[model samples]
Target: MMKFKVLFLLTIIGLVTCSVNAQRGVRIGYIDTEYILQNVPEYKEASSQLDKKVQQWKTEIETKLNAIEQKKKELDNESVLLTKELYDERYEDITFEEAEVLDYQQKRFGPEGDLMIQKRQLIEPIQDQIFAAVQEIAETKSYDFVFDKSADVVMLYSAERYDMSEQVLRTITRTSKRSQAKSKKERQELEDEEVVPVVSADKDERQQALEDRKASREEQLAAKREEREKAAEERKQAQQDLRDAKKKEAEERRQKVIDERNARSGSTSNEAKTVESDSTAKAKSIVKADSVKVQGTVKKDSVNSKMPKTAAEIAAEERAQKLKDREARQKELEARKQKIIDQRKKAREERERQVKKNDSIAKAKKNEDNN
Candidate 1:
């Protein structure tokens, strides 16, 4: 009967253990202390103030050192004229000044110095607040263990789902707001303020947030790409329009030149001038012969081809010949322009070389004179 009772007691204990195990499971989370510190405005302000102090101390030290350096330079320059006793006194003064500056630097910034002390003083309260926030979050979220990711404890691999840094920052913000409230009305207002709900370590929620951020980034990229494409298209259209306008202007100029040539030919037609004096006609013949000789050198084949063609055909042939001559003249002009540019480039290079040679000669002579 005693054995049976003992077995019943052991079975009851085992059942209670199984019930407890089923009721609870370990839920671990961690906060990044460095991230928390960066988000805390009070800590940031304190750090900025400390940095200013450090800068001021560094400037002071630099000024003293510069003064010492200037004194040493002056002492070296005047050493030949100075008495031994006076030189020793100035040297001692500079040495002592340097030592003082170094000591001041150490006092302000050394390991056991004011800088470290002020940093600890500024950060301790912030750390306490963080600890309280972390504790509150852990308790409220039913977290079995909460670790500091930025602490000395090494975390080789940590999942993003377990990060609670944002919650800690929110808690800090709320606490600060509550502390700043000076009246019941302000407290009520702060309490009524719409705050973002703290996200727990739910995989679905974290995944959704990540996806939202990714979608937002992609949208921004798409907007920027669309803007770029629009700008590029505008630039391309503007360039094409400019090219078309230039081509139209060139065609107009060519047509105007052809019309002027046709008008001149008609005015100087054989059917019009039948009343010129003999000498004037002779002079005209002389000028015409000279011009024909010049034209013969350029055009081996004459436009006055002896093919019994119609007036319209002759005019078309002449116009075509004129166009070819104009194009040849343009080519010759471009070649001359290129030749002139090359000559100028060569002349410039020669001038530069001559100037360098003269400078070298002058430098050599000056050095010889100095020696």
Candidate 2:
């Protein structure tokens, strides 16, 4: 019985030990990719240099496009001055020139511009190197999956404990430096191969031809520089002419506005003068009428003064005049009030008629349904 109890206790202890091992097998880790990208000097330099080259290419293409546009404009203008026969002959030449310009533009700026593009294509391999380093660190550290906390998918990660970005970045930088040195050595060896020994007549002739070609190229470059400067000056003059034309047009518009304002002011002044003359004539007529009324009043006063003067007559006259004015005002107010009351009654009747008409139509509809 004691042996049986000892065996059962050992089995229980073994089961607990297995459970603890299973729990300990689980692994999790995180890496901050953004931190690595920001901290890595090589990555920063490569990205900045690539951006600068791209900008330079863009500016060169823009200048070429502007030159082509100017040539097209010149060709268009020349076509107007040429005879029909000459125009037809020149048409093919101009078309060929335009095509050549376009082809050159595409060659220099298109997908196959330079070997630098192939160098840029190697960025994927560099990225792969970093990823491989990360994988190595993850596997060596026994991490099941290394999540990037900078990707924002991992809500919480202990910075010191979870980060493997520094390790990966250091590994990548060291590998890239070694690869770059090796590539440079290889390039130097290739460049050395291009140097030929000047022993044969054929080699001497080739060397002379090369020197002549280089001299011719230098002369062509100088001519091109002069042409570019002349073209720049022409463009500046054309821009200045455009500005002057616009300024002249603006001045003409300003003068036109001033002339219109002057005409309007003149018309307004004439209207004011006419109004003043009409007002003077009206004032003269009013003065004449006042004089006539005053003369009539003077005659009546002289007649009344010669006849009689009495206080009771004046009092009766004022009383009668006041009564008449009061009755006239009262009658006007009563007429206005009655007119408003009649309008309101008409509106009420019209509303009632409309309501009745609607009710009759509804009743007819209900009757028709019942039938």
Candidate 3:
């Protein structure tokens, strides 16, 4: 209830704010920050670099922890035979290493840590540029108010046309392209005079080696990421194909079973139809014979002597006809009910077969996996 109340108040406040903005003739627009970030190459590169570093750091941490665990196990196993002095030294060494690992983990992953600082440094410039680009777009478009749809602003509805992210991205992209072109032109002018590439000739060999190692590390990280993604995609496609094959096989088996059942029932239906036809023909023959016998027993002026049918007699014939119609309808209903029942039975059987097939497939897969 408290949450609901808070939400209600917030909604009311938002409505009032929008209403005030509208009364002041303000135009509103929104931008998706996440979308803009996705479009920014520098942001992606930074993120990938961060991810690589994080992975490396995590691996280092795990390796250190595992080493400590192994040493502890060995010390425990040999403790009974070892002298107290030696045992204490080994245990002290393990504790020191464990402390070092914990310190390193905290340095990499704790709040206000090296990784956090590096990440902030990496993204701060990009974020500033994005904000500047957004500002420029807002100014040129004469937008009175712009909101970030990606932010924690509550949005019950948003229209696509009001989005200004594309505008911001376009502005940023143009600036980057111009910067690149200017740099390239400068490099070309230098190259036209046959100037050699700058190789930091004054730098120490150690510094140069460090820079070289950093470049190689980045390249390896990029290559590994690409390979991993490619392998993952291939695995996904293979799994999809396997699933499709299984589904196709299941469907074909079910269809074949239904077809065979229908064929068998078709013969029975044909025989029933033949028997009904014979019964109908026999019934018609008997009626004809009775009519002839009645005609032979009647006088020649029987029609003339007979009175016309009264309303009650006509109504009686109509009632008889209605009863016969109702009986025919009941028979049709029964037939339809029987068909539905048969269909349900067939469906249940098919489901059971499918379940059995799935169980067999699962069992086979488990066996394969175990092997």
Highest lDDT against the true fold, candidate: 1
Query: lDDT of candidate 2 vs native?
Result: 0.67
Model 2 per-residue lDDT tens digits across residues 102-162: 7766765677865356445645665677688777766665567777776759464374745
User: How does each model score on TM-score?
Assistant: 0.48, 0.34, 0.43
- Over the stretch 321-362, how does candidate 3's per-residue lDDT look in tens digits? 565565566567657756765775687578668866976886
Model 1 C-alpha lDDT versus the unseen true structure: 0.78
Each model's lDDT comes to 0.78, 0.67, 0.75
Residue 126 shift from truth in candidate 3, angstroms: 1.3
**Quick one: RMSD of model 2?**
34.4
In Å, residue 284's CA in model 3 sits off its true spot by: 35
- Top model number, TM-score: 1
Residue-wise lDDT of candidate 1 within 178-238, one digit each (tens)? 9998999988877775244454456555687899999999999999999999999999999
**Decreasing lDDT order of the candidates:** 1, 3, 2
Cα-based RMSD of candidate 3: 33.0
Misplaced by over 4 Å in model 2 are 1-22, 29-38, 84-116, 147-163, 173-371
